[model samples]
Target: MTHRISCELAEAPLAPGEVAIVGAGPGDPGLLTLRALSLLEQADCLVFDRLVSREVLALASPKARRFYVGKASRCHALTQEQTNALLVRLAGEGRRVVRLKGGDPYIFGRGGEEGEVLIAHGIRFRVVPGITSAQGCAAYGGFPLTHRDHAQSVTFVTGHRKGDGELILDWSALAVPHHTAVFYMGLANAGTISRQLQAHGLPASHPVALVERGTTPEQRRVITCLGELVATIAREGLTPPTLIVVGEVVRLADTLAQPAAQVAILAEGEIRDRVGERVAL
Candidate 1:
Protein backbone atom coordinates (compact mmCIF):
# COMPACT_ATOMS: atom_id res chain seq x y z
CA MET A 1 0.00 0.00 0.00
CA THR A 2 1.26 3.47 -0.85
CA HIS A 3 0.55 6.48 1.42
CA ARG A 4 0.33 9.99 -0.01
CA ILE A 5 2.06 12.86 1.79
CA SER A 6 -0.23 15.88 1.72
CA CYS A 7 1.08 18.41 4.24
CA GLU A 8 1.35 21.99 3.03
CA LEU A 9 3.49 24.21 5.28
CA ALA A 10 2.37 27.84 5.11
CA GLU A 11 5.55 29.40 6.50
CA ALA A 12 8.56 30.75 4.67
CA PRO A 13 11.93 29.09 5.03
CA LEU A 14 14.03 30.27 7.97
CA ALA A 15 16.60 32.82 6.84
CA PRO A 16 20.33 32.41 7.52
CA GLY A 17 21.63 33.97 10.77
CA GLU A 18 18.17 33.53 12.25
CA VAL A 19 17.31 31.42 15.28
CA ALA A 20 13.99 29.59 15.62
CA ILE A 21 13.22 28.43 19.14
CA VAL A 22 10.63 25.73 18.49
CA GLY A 23 8.81 23.35 20.82
CA ALA A 24 8.95 19.63 19.86
CA GLY A 25 5.75 18.86 21.87
CA PRO A 26 5.46 16.21 24.59
CA GLY A 27 7.34 13.09 23.41
CA ASP A 28 5.10 12.43 20.36
CA PRO A 29 6.50 13.39 16.96
CA GLY A 30 3.00 13.65 15.50
CA LEU A 31 2.27 16.58 17.85
CA LEU A 32 4.87 18.77 16.13
CA THR A 33 3.45 21.88 14.37
CA LEU A 34 3.83 22.73 10.70
CA ARG A 35 6.05 25.77 11.38
CA ALA A 36 8.29 23.68 13.59
CA LEU A 37 8.56 21.01 10.90
CA SER A 38 9.45 23.63 8.32
CA LEU A 39 12.13 25.07 10.54
CA LEU A 40 13.59 21.61 11.15
CA GLU A 41 13.80 20.91 7.44
CA GLN A 42 15.41 24.28 6.66
CA ALA A 43 17.73 24.56 9.62
CA ASP A 44 21.45 24.44 9.02
CA CYS A 45 22.01 23.44 12.66
CA LEU A 46 19.70 21.75 15.19
CA VAL A 47 20.34 22.15 18.94
CA PHE A 48 18.12 19.74 20.83
CA ASP A 49 17.62 18.55 24.39
CA ARG A 50 17.08 15.12 25.95
CA LEU A 51 13.30 15.34 26.24
CA VAL A 52 13.01 15.79 22.47
CA SER A 53 11.92 12.46 20.99
CA ARG A 54 14.27 10.66 18.56
CA GLU A 55 11.30 10.46 16.19
CA VAL A 56 11.04 14.24 16.05
CA LEU A 57 14.78 14.62 15.47
CA ALA A 58 14.55 12.09 12.66
CA LEU A 59 12.31 14.57 10.80
CA ALA A 60 15.16 17.02 10.45
CA SER A 61 17.37 17.25 7.39
CA PRO A 62 20.02 14.54 7.27
CA LYS A 63 22.70 17.12 6.50
CA ALA A 64 21.75 19.39 9.42
CA ARG A 65 24.41 19.74 12.08
CA ARG A 66 23.08 18.30 15.36
CA PHE A 67 24.00 19.33 18.90
CA TYR A 68 22.95 17.39 21.99
CA VAL A 69 22.62 19.69 25.00
CA GLY A 70 20.21 17.76 27.16
CA LYS A 71 19.95 18.64 30.85
CA ALA A 72 18.68 15.94 33.18
CA SER A 73 17.82 16.23 36.84
CA ARG A 74 21.03 16.57 38.90
CA CYS A 75 23.03 16.25 35.67
CA HIS A 76 23.92 18.89 33.12
CA ALA A 77 25.29 18.20 29.66
CA LEU A 78 25.32 21.97 29.01
CA THR A 79 24.56 24.78 31.43
CA GLN A 80 21.81 27.27 30.61
CA GLU A 81 24.31 30.09 30.25
CA GLN A 82 26.41 27.93 27.99
CA THR A 83 23.36 27.12 25.87
CA ASN A 84 22.51 30.81 25.60
CA ALA A 85 26.05 31.62 24.53
CA LEU A 86 26.02 28.79 22.01
CA LEU A 87 22.87 30.11 20.35
CA VAL A 88 24.44 33.54 20.08
CA ARG A 89 27.61 32.11 18.62
CA LEU A 90 25.72 29.92 16.15
CA ALA A 91 23.59 32.80 14.88
CA GLY A 92 26.77 34.90 14.57
CA GLU A 93 28.08 32.21 12.23
CA GLY A 94 25.13 32.93 9.88
CA ARG A 95 23.51 29.50 10.28
CA ARG A 96 19.76 28.94 10.38
CA VAL A 97 19.78 27.63 13.95
CA VAL A 98 16.82 25.67 15.30
CA ARG A 99 16.87 25.51 19.10
CA LEU A 100 14.37 22.76 19.75
CA LYS A 101 12.84 22.20 23.19
CA GLY A 102 10.59 19.42 24.51
CA GLY A 103 7.54 21.56 25.25
CA ASP A 104 6.41 25.14 24.75
CA PRO A 105 9.65 27.08 25.25
CA TYR A 106 7.85 29.97 26.97
CA ILE A 107 6.50 27.63 29.64
CA PHE A 108 9.40 26.64 31.88
CA GLY A 109 11.64 25.84 28.86
CA ARG A 110 13.55 29.13 29.34
CA GLY A 111 13.02 30.45 25.83
CA GLY A 112 12.69 33.94 27.22
CA GLU A 113 16.25 33.96 28.54
CA GLU A 114 17.60 32.81 25.18
CA GLY A 115 15.45 35.37 23.38
CA GLU A 116 16.82 38.04 25.69
CA VAL A 117 20.39 37.17 24.72
CA LEU A 118 19.46 37.07 21.07
CA ILE A 119 17.91 40.54 21.25
CA ALA A 120 20.98 41.90 23.01
CA HIS A 121 23.16 40.46 20.29
CA GLY A 122 20.88 41.88 17.53
CA ILE A 123 20.19 38.44 16.06
CA ARG A 124 16.94 37.80 14.21
CA PHE A 125 14.80 35.21 15.95
CA ARG A 126 11.27 33.74 15.98
CA VAL A 127 9.35 31.49 18.35
CA VAL A 128 7.13 28.59 17.27
CA PRO A 129 4.89 27.44 20.10
CA GLY A 130 4.17 23.74 20.51
CA ILE A 131 1.72 21.82 22.71
CA THR A 132 2.85 21.83 26.31
CA SER A 133 3.26 18.59 28.23
CA ALA A 134 0.32 19.38 30.46
CA GLN A 135 -1.98 19.75 27.46
CA GLY A 136 -0.53 16.80 25.56
CA CYS A 137 -0.29 14.48 28.55
CA ALA A 138 -3.72 15.32 29.90
CA ALA A 139 -5.28 14.65 26.50
CA TYR A 140 -3.54 11.30 25.90
CA GLY A 141 -4.04 10.31 29.53
CA GLY A 142 -7.79 10.83 28.94
CA PHE A 143 -8.42 13.58 31.48
CA PRO A 144 -9.61 17.09 30.93
CA LEU A 145 -7.71 19.88 32.59
CA THR A 146 -10.87 21.86 33.04
CA HIS A 147 -14.49 20.76 33.23
CA ARG A 148 -17.65 22.50 34.34
CA ASP A 149 -18.30 19.95 37.04
CA HIS A 150 -14.70 19.48 38.13
CA ALA A 151 -12.49 22.46 37.37
CA GLN A 152 -13.25 26.03 36.36
CA SER A 153 -9.61 27.07 35.97
CA VAL A 154 -6.26 25.45 35.27
CA THR A 155 -2.69 26.42 36.23
CA PHE A 156 0.70 25.04 35.20
CA VAL A 157 3.65 25.29 37.57
CA THR A 158 7.19 23.95 37.74
CA GLY A 159 8.09 21.63 40.59
CA HIS A 160 11.85 21.94 40.07
CA ARG A 161 13.08 24.31 42.71
CA LYS A 162 16.45 26.04 42.82
CA GLY A 163 18.99 23.38 43.83
CA ASP A 164 15.97 21.12 44.34
CA GLY A 165 15.15 23.20 47.35
CA GLU A 166 11.68 23.99 48.69
CA LEU A 167 9.24 24.71 45.87
CA ILE A 168 7.96 28.23 46.48
CA LEU A 169 4.54 27.98 44.89
CA ASP A 170 1.20 29.52 45.85
CA TRP A 171 -0.11 26.59 47.78
CA SER A 172 -3.02 28.52 49.24
CA ALA A 173 -4.19 29.60 45.82
CA LEU A 174 -3.64 26.15 44.32
CA ALA A 175 -5.64 24.58 47.09
CA VAL A 176 -8.77 26.39 46.08
CA PRO A 177 -11.76 24.44 44.82
CA HIS A 178 -12.64 23.94 41.17
CA HIS A 179 -9.05 24.44 40.01
CA THR A 180 -6.69 22.09 38.16
CA ALA A 181 -2.95 22.22 38.82
CA VAL A 182 -0.33 20.61 36.58
CA PHE A 183 3.24 20.38 37.79
CA TYR A 184 6.19 19.79 35.46
CA MET A 185 9.37 18.09 36.69
CA GLY A 186 7.46 17.31 39.89
CA LEU A 187 8.13 13.65 40.57
CA ALA A 188 11.18 14.16 42.79
CA ASN A 189 9.36 16.68 44.94
CA ALA A 190 6.10 14.77 45.06
CA GLY A 191 6.21 14.40 48.82
CA THR A 192 6.60 18.09 49.44
CA ILE A 193 3.91 18.94 46.95
CA SER A 194 1.34 16.61 48.48
CA ARG A 195 2.09 17.78 52.00
CA GLN A 196 1.86 21.42 51.11
CA LEU A 197 -1.33 21.03 49.15
CA GLN A 198 -3.03 19.07 51.90
CA ALA A 199 -1.82 21.47 54.57
CA HIS A 200 -3.21 24.34 52.52
CA GLY A 201 -6.72 22.81 52.39
CA LEU A 202 -6.72 20.36 49.50
CA PRO A 203 -8.02 17.16 50.99
CA ALA A 204 -5.74 14.12 51.24
CA SER A 205 -8.28 12.11 49.29
CA HIS A 206 -8.24 14.50 46.36
CA PRO A 207 -7.73 12.78 43.03
CA VAL A 208 -4.32 12.87 41.32
CA ALA A 209 -2.82 11.40 38.15
CA LEU A 210 0.86 10.71 37.60
CA VAL A 211 1.34 10.35 33.88
CA GLU A 212 4.69 8.77 32.94
CA ARG A 213 6.14 9.32 29.46
CA GLY A 214 2.80 10.84 28.55
CA THR A 215 1.60 11.19 24.94
CA THR A 216 4.06 8.49 23.76
CA PRO A 217 3.59 4.85 22.96
CA GLU A 218 5.17 3.93 26.31
CA GLN A 219 2.74 6.05 28.27
CA ARG A 220 1.78 4.91 31.79
CA ARG A 221 -0.91 6.43 33.98
CA VAL A 222 -0.93 5.78 37.72
CA ILE A 223 -4.12 6.91 39.37
CA THR A 224 -4.08 7.63 43.07
CA CYS A 225 -5.36 10.05 45.68
CA LEU A 226 -3.40 13.15 46.67
CA GLY A 227 -2.54 11.56 50.04
CA GLU A 228 -0.76 8.73 48.29
CA LEU A 229 0.95 10.77 45.59
CA VAL A 230 4.52 10.18 46.74
CA ALA A 231 3.92 6.60 47.78
CA THR A 232 2.24 5.80 44.50
CA ILE A 233 5.21 7.14 42.55
CA ALA A 234 7.56 4.96 44.64
CA ARG A 235 5.32 1.93 44.15
CA GLU A 236 5.34 2.40 40.38
CA GLY A 237 9.02 3.51 40.10
CA LEU A 238 7.93 6.47 38.01
CA THR A 239 10.63 8.81 36.74
CA PRO A 240 11.21 12.25 35.30
CA PRO A 241 9.45 13.55 32.15
CA THR A 242 6.38 12.53 34.15
CA LEU A 243 3.63 15.09 34.73
CA ILE A 244 1.57 15.44 37.93
CA VAL A 245 -2.04 16.51 37.52
CA VAL A 246 -4.09 17.31 40.61
CA GLY A 247 -7.79 18.09 40.65
CA GLU A 248 -11.16 16.45 40.84
CA VAL A 249 -10.88 16.24 37.06
CA VAL A 250 -8.25 13.53 37.46
CA ARG A 251 -10.93 11.14 38.68
CA LEU A 252 -12.47 11.22 35.22
CA ALA A 253 -9.53 9.17 33.95
CA ASP A 254 -11.24 6.11 35.37
CA THR A 255 -13.68 6.36 32.49
CA LEU A 256 -11.69 8.23 29.84
CA ALA A 257 -8.30 6.45 29.77
CA GLN A 258 -7.11 4.62 26.68
CA PRO A 259 -4.84 1.59 26.44
CA ALA A 260 -1.07 2.09 26.45
CA ALA A 261 -0.36 -1.08 24.51
CA GLN A 262 1.34 0.41 21.49
CA VAL A 263 4.84 -0.47 22.72
CA ALA A 264 4.30 -3.61 24.76
CA ILE A 265 7.30 -5.88 25.30
CA LEU A 266 7.85 -9.64 25.33
CA ALA A 267 9.77 -10.67 28.43
CA GLU A 268 10.78 -13.99 29.92
CA GLY A 269 8.94 -15.83 27.14
CA GLU A 270 5.77 -13.96 27.98
CA ILE A 271 4.16 -10.94 26.42
CA ARG A 272 3.55 -8.37 29.15
CA ASP A 273 0.76 -6.24 27.86
CA ARG A 274 -1.05 -3.38 29.60
CA VAL A 275 -4.71 -3.68 28.65
CA GLY A 276 -6.96 -0.69 28.04
CA GLU A 277 -7.49 0.02 31.70
CA ARG A 278 -6.34 2.59 34.22
CA VAL A 279 -4.07 1.42 37.04
CA ALA A 280 -4.96 2.63 40.51
CA LEU A 281 -2.43 2.38 43.30
Candidate 2:
Protein backbone atom coordinates (compact mmCIF):
# COMPACT_ATOMS: atom_id res chain seq x y z
CA MET A 1 0.00 0.00 0.00
CA THR A 2 2.91 2.32 -0.60
CA HIS A 3 1.58 4.29 -3.54
CA ARG A 4 3.81 7.14 -4.68
CA ILE A 5 2.03 10.39 -3.81
CA SER A 6 4.38 12.82 -5.56
CA CYS A 7 6.81 12.66 -8.46
CA GLU A 8 10.28 13.97 -9.44
CA LEU A 9 9.04 16.09 -12.33
CA ALA A 10 9.64 19.54 -10.74
CA GLU A 11 12.62 20.04 -8.43
CA ALA A 12 13.81 22.57 -10.99
CA PRO A 13 14.80 26.20 -10.60
CA LEU A 14 12.45 29.14 -10.42
CA ALA A 15 13.10 32.36 -12.40
CA PRO A 16 14.45 34.14 -9.29
CA GLY A 17 11.60 36.50 -8.24
CA GLU A 18 8.76 34.48 -9.73
CA VAL A 19 5.46 34.17 -7.87
CA ALA A 20 3.27 31.27 -8.89
CA ILE A 21 -0.50 31.29 -8.43
CA VAL A 22 -1.11 27.63 -7.64
CA GLY A 23 -4.34 25.83 -6.82
CA ALA A 24 -4.38 23.45 -3.83
CA GLY A 25 -7.11 21.38 -5.48
CA PRO A 26 -10.47 20.52 -3.93
CA GLY A 27 -9.34 20.02 -0.32
CA ASP A 28 -7.59 16.76 -1.19
CA PRO A 29 -3.82 16.68 -0.79
CA GLY A 30 -3.58 13.79 -3.25
CA LEU A 31 -4.98 15.97 -6.06
CA LEU A 32 -2.11 18.47 -5.83
CA THR A 33 0.44 18.34 -8.61
CA LEU A 34 4.10 17.53 -8.12
CA ARG A 35 4.97 21.00 -9.37
CA ALA A 36 2.67 22.66 -6.86
CA LEU A 37 3.89 20.62 -3.93
CA SER A 38 7.48 21.13 -5.01
CA LEU A 39 6.93 24.86 -5.21
CA LEU A 40 5.47 24.81 -1.71
CA GLU A 41 8.60 23.02 -0.55
CA GLN A 42 10.70 25.99 -1.53
CA ALA A 43 8.23 28.79 -1.01
CA ASP A 44 9.56 31.52 1.28
CA CYS A 45 6.08 32.92 1.84
CA LEU A 46 2.77 31.09 1.55
CA VAL A 47 -0.46 33.06 1.13
CA PHE A 48 -3.55 30.88 1.27
CA ASP A 49 -7.30 31.26 1.55
CA ARG A 50 -9.52 29.79 4.27
CA LEU A 51 -10.71 27.20 1.81
CA VAL A 52 -7.18 25.80 1.69
CA SER A 53 -7.12 22.69 3.85
CA ARG A 54 -4.77 22.57 6.84
CA GLU A 55 -3.63 19.14 5.63
CA VAL A 56 -2.21 20.75 2.51
CA LEU A 57 -0.72 23.60 4.52
CA ALA A 58 1.27 21.13 6.59
CA LEU A 59 3.24 20.14 3.49
CA ALA A 60 4.85 23.57 3.14
CA SER A 61 8.36 24.11 4.36
CA PRO A 62 8.70 24.70 8.09
CA LYS A 63 10.64 27.87 7.27
CA ALA A 64 7.90 29.23 5.04
CA ARG A 65 6.03 32.34 6.19
CA ARG A 66 2.33 31.49 6.36
CA PHE A 67 -0.28 34.14 5.65
CA TYR A 68 -3.92 33.14 5.90
CA VAL A 69 -6.00 35.55 3.85
CA GLY A 70 -9.00 33.32 3.55
CA LYS A 71 -12.16 34.74 1.98
CA ALA A 72 -15.67 33.45 1.38
CA SER A 73 -19.26 34.33 2.19
CA ARG A 74 -19.79 35.12 5.91
CA CYS A 75 -16.01 35.38 6.26
CA HIS A 76 -13.87 37.89 4.41
CA ALA A 77 -10.59 37.87 6.31
CA LEU A 78 -9.03 40.13 3.70
CA THR A 79 -10.79 42.49 1.37
CA GLN A 80 -10.28 41.99 -2.36
CA GLU A 81 -8.23 45.16 -2.48
CA GLN A 82 -6.12 43.99 0.45
CA THR A 83 -5.44 40.66 -1.23
CA ASN A 84 -4.33 42.40 -4.42
CA ALA A 85 -2.04 44.71 -2.52
CA LEU A 86 -0.68 41.79 -0.48
CA LEU A 87 0.35 39.93 -3.61
CA VAL A 88 2.08 42.99 -5.02
CA ARG A 89 3.83 43.64 -1.74
CA LEU A 90 4.92 40.00 -1.36
CA ALA A 91 6.43 39.96 -4.84
CA GLY A 92 8.14 43.31 -4.25
CA GLU A 93 9.99 41.69 -1.34
CA GLY A 94 11.50 39.15 -3.76
CA ARG A 95 9.79 36.34 -1.88
CA ARG A 96 8.87 33.14 -3.69
CA VAL A 97 5.18 33.31 -2.94
CA VAL A 98 2.58 30.66 -3.53
CA ARG A 99 -1.03 31.84 -3.68
CA LEU A 100 -2.85 28.63 -2.90
CA LYS A 101 -6.55 28.54 -3.61
CA GLY A 102 -9.08 25.78 -3.04
CA GLY A 103 -10.20 24.15 -6.22
CA ASP A 104 -9.03 25.57 -9.58
CA PRO A 105 -7.63 29.08 -9.40
CA TYR A 106 -9.36 29.96 -12.66
CA ILE A 107 -12.80 28.73 -11.72
CA PHE A 108 -14.47 31.59 -9.82
CA GLY A 109 -11.51 31.62 -7.49
CA ARG A 110 -10.94 35.35 -8.26
CA GLY A 111 -7.61 34.40 -9.81
CA GLY A 112 -8.09 36.73 -12.77
CA GLU A 113 -8.34 39.73 -10.48
CA GLU A 114 -5.13 38.81 -8.68
CA GLY A 115 -3.38 38.14 -12.00
CA GLU A 116 -4.34 41.63 -13.10
CA VAL A 117 -2.55 43.07 -10.10
CA LEU A 118 0.55 41.01 -10.83
CA ILE A 119 0.55 42.27 -14.41
CA ALA A 120 0.14 45.85 -13.30
CA HIS A 121 3.04 45.49 -10.90
CA GLY A 122 5.22 43.78 -13.52
CA ILE A 123 5.58 40.67 -11.36
CA ARG A 124 6.45 37.45 -13.13
CA PHE A 125 3.87 34.77 -12.36
CA ARG A 126 2.64 31.45 -13.67
CA VAL A 127 -0.73 29.78 -13.13
CA VAL A 128 -0.68 26.17 -11.97
CA PRO A 129 -4.20 24.90 -12.51
CA GLY A 130 -5.87 22.37 -10.19
CA ILE A 131 -9.18 20.57 -10.03
CA THR A 132 -12.20 22.76 -9.30
CA SER A 133 -14.50 21.57 -6.53
CA ALA A 134 -17.38 21.31 -8.97
CA GLN A 135 -15.44 18.83 -11.05
CA GLY A 136 -13.79 17.16 -8.06
CA CYS A 137 -16.94 16.83 -6.00
CA ALA A 138 -18.92 15.57 -8.96
CA ALA A 139 -16.46 12.78 -9.59
CA TYR A 140 -16.19 11.85 -5.91
CA GLY A 141 -19.95 12.09 -5.45
CA GLY A 142 -20.35 9.70 -8.39
CA PHE A 143 -21.93 12.25 -10.71
CA PRO A 144 -20.30 13.08 -14.01
CA LEU A 145 -20.76 16.62 -15.21
CA THR A 146 -21.60 15.16 -18.57
CA HIS A 147 -22.79 11.66 -19.29
CA ARG A 148 -23.43 11.06 -22.98
CA ASP A 149 -27.03 10.18 -22.26
CA HIS A 150 -27.65 12.79 -19.57
CA ALA A 151 -26.10 15.98 -20.80
CA GLN A 152 -24.31 17.62 -23.69
CA SER A 153 -22.78 20.48 -21.72
CA VAL A 154 -22.26 21.65 -18.13
CA THR A 155 -22.27 25.19 -16.75
CA PHE A 156 -20.80 26.32 -13.43
CA VAL A 157 -22.37 29.39 -11.82
CA THR A 158 -22.36 31.18 -8.48
CA GLY A 159 -25.83 31.17 -6.98
CA HIS A 160 -25.35 34.13 -4.65
CA ARG A 161 -23.52 37.42 -4.50
CA LYS A 162 -22.13 39.91 -2.01
CA GLY A 163 -24.36 42.46 -0.18
CA ASP A 164 -27.41 40.21 -0.50
CA GLY A 165 -27.96 41.22 -4.10
CA GLU A 166 -30.57 39.46 -6.12
CA LEU A 167 -29.41 36.63 -8.34
CA ILE A 168 -29.14 37.69 -11.96
CA LEU A 169 -29.22 34.20 -13.39
CA ASP A 170 -31.63 33.51 -16.22
CA TRP A 171 -33.72 31.05 -14.32
CA SER A 172 -36.17 30.41 -17.12
CA ALA A 173 -33.28 29.54 -19.37
CA LEU A 174 -31.36 27.67 -16.67
CA ALA A 175 -34.37 25.57 -15.76
CA VAL A 176 -34.34 23.83 -19.09
CA PRO A 177 -33.44 20.16 -19.12
CA HIS A 178 -30.37 18.61 -20.81
CA HIS A 179 -27.93 21.08 -19.29
CA THR A 180 -26.29 20.46 -15.90
CA ALA A 181 -25.73 23.35 -13.47
CA VAL A 182 -23.04 23.38 -10.83
CA PHE A 183 -23.18 26.10 -8.19
CA TYR A 184 -20.19 27.13 -6.11
CA MET A 185 -20.21 29.44 -3.05
CA GLY A 186 -23.92 28.91 -2.79
CA LEU A 187 -24.54 27.53 0.69
CA ALA A 188 -26.91 30.27 1.83
CA ASN A 189 -29.10 30.30 -1.22
CA ALA A 190 -30.26 26.71 -1.30
CA GLY A 191 -33.87 27.60 -0.73
CA THR A 192 -33.96 30.42 -3.23
CA ILE A 193 -32.07 28.37 -5.77
CA SER A 194 -34.62 25.61 -5.57
CA ARG A 195 -37.63 27.93 -5.66
CA GLN A 196 -36.30 29.91 -8.59
CA LEU A 197 -35.63 26.84 -10.63
CA GLN A 198 -39.15 25.68 -10.00
CA ALA A 199 -40.66 29.03 -10.91
CA HIS A 200 -38.78 29.00 -14.18
CA GLY A 201 -40.36 25.89 -15.65
CA LEU A 202 -37.98 23.28 -14.29
CA PRO A 203 -39.89 20.39 -12.91
CA ALA A 204 -40.20 20.20 -9.16
CA SER A 205 -39.00 16.63 -9.42
CA HIS A 206 -35.74 17.41 -11.22
CA PRO A 207 -32.82 15.65 -9.55
CA VAL A 208 -30.27 17.55 -7.46
CA ALA A 209 -27.17 16.69 -5.49
CA LEU A 210 -25.64 18.74 -2.69
CA VAL A 211 -22.12 17.73 -1.75
CA GLU A 212 -20.48 19.19 1.37
CA ARG A 213 -16.71 19.12 1.92
CA GLY A 214 -16.52 16.81 -1.03
CA THR A 215 -13.58 14.46 -1.62
CA THR A 216 -12.61 14.41 2.06
CA PRO A 217 -13.43 12.16 5.03
CA GLU A 218 -16.12 14.62 6.14
CA GLN A 219 -17.80 14.69 2.76
CA ARG A 220 -21.61 14.53 2.80
CA ARG A 221 -23.80 14.06 -0.22
CA VAL A 222 -27.56 14.39 -0.40
CA ILE A 223 -29.41 13.08 -3.42
CA THR A 224 -32.85 14.53 -3.80
CA CYS A 225 -35.22 16.01 -6.32
CA LEU A 226 -35.70 19.73 -6.95
CA GLY A 227 -38.83 19.75 -4.80
CA GLU A 228 -37.07 18.89 -1.57
CA LEU A 229 -33.38 19.91 -1.87
CA VAL A 230 -33.55 23.10 0.15
CA ALA A 231 -35.61 21.50 2.87
CA THR A 232 -33.52 18.39 2.91
CA ILE A 233 -30.22 20.23 3.41
CA ALA A 234 -31.87 22.27 6.15
CA ARG A 235 -33.14 19.12 7.78
CA GLU A 236 -29.75 17.48 7.56
CA GLY A 237 -28.03 20.67 8.87
CA LEU A 238 -25.14 20.55 6.43
CA THR A 239 -22.78 23.55 6.49
CA PRO A 240 -20.53 25.36 4.02
CA PRO A 241 -17.96 23.99 1.55
CA THR A 242 -21.05 22.74 -0.24
CA LEU A 243 -21.43 22.45 -3.99
CA ILE A 244 -24.82 22.10 -5.63
CA VAL A 245 -25.42 20.12 -8.79
CA VAL A 246 -28.67 20.01 -10.70
CA GLY A 247 -29.44 17.63 -13.55
CA GLU A 248 -30.29 14.05 -14.40
CA VAL A 249 -26.67 13.22 -13.64
CA VAL A 250 -27.40 13.65 -9.92
CA ARG A 251 -29.56 10.57 -10.16
CA LEU A 252 -26.66 8.32 -11.12
CA ALA A 253 -24.61 8.13 -7.87
CA ASP A 254 -26.01 4.79 -6.73
CA THR A 255 -25.85 3.33 -10.21
CA LEU A 256 -22.28 4.52 -10.70
CA ALA A 257 -21.02 3.48 -7.27
CA GLN A 258 -19.83 -0.01 -6.33
CA PRO A 259 -20.50 -1.35 -2.85
CA ALA A 260 -19.22 0.97 -0.07
CA ALA A 261 -16.10 -0.88 1.09
CA GLN A 262 -14.69 -1.58 -2.36
CA VAL A 263 -14.19 2.05 -3.47
CA ALA A 264 -10.53 2.40 -2.55
CA ILE A 265 -9.62 -0.94 -4.10
CA LEU A 266 -11.76 -0.13 -7.09
CA ALA A 267 -10.05 3.25 -7.48
CA GLU A 268 -6.69 1.53 -7.62
CA GLY A 269 -7.68 -0.86 -10.36
CA GLU A 270 -10.86 -1.75 -12.25
CA ILE A 271 -12.55 1.63 -11.74
CA ARG A 272 -9.83 3.61 -13.44
CA ASP A 273 -9.39 1.00 -16.14
CA ARG A 274 -13.08 0.95 -16.98
CA VAL A 275 -13.43 4.72 -16.69
CA GLY A 276 -10.30 5.33 -18.75
CA GLU A 277 -11.64 3.12 -21.49
CA ARG A 278 -15.05 4.76 -21.37
CA VAL A 279 -13.49 8.21 -21.28
CA ALA A 280 -11.54 7.47 -24.46
CA LEU A 281 -14.77 8.00 -26.33
- Per-model lDDT: 0.84, 0.79
Give me the candidate number with maximum lDDT. Answer: 1
What TM-score does prediction 2 earn?
0.87
Q: Which residue pairs clash within candidate 1? A: none
Which regions of candidate 2 fall more than 4 Å away from where they truly are? Answer: 1-12, 259-281
Shift of residue 211 alpha carbon in model 1, Å: 0.5
Best by TM-score: 1
Assess every candidate by TM-score. 0.90, 0.87
Write model 1 residue lDDT over 40-128, tens digit each, in one string.
Answer: 88889999988999888988889999999999887988999999889999999999999999989999999999999999999999999
Candidate 2 lDDT (Cα, 0 to 1): 0.79
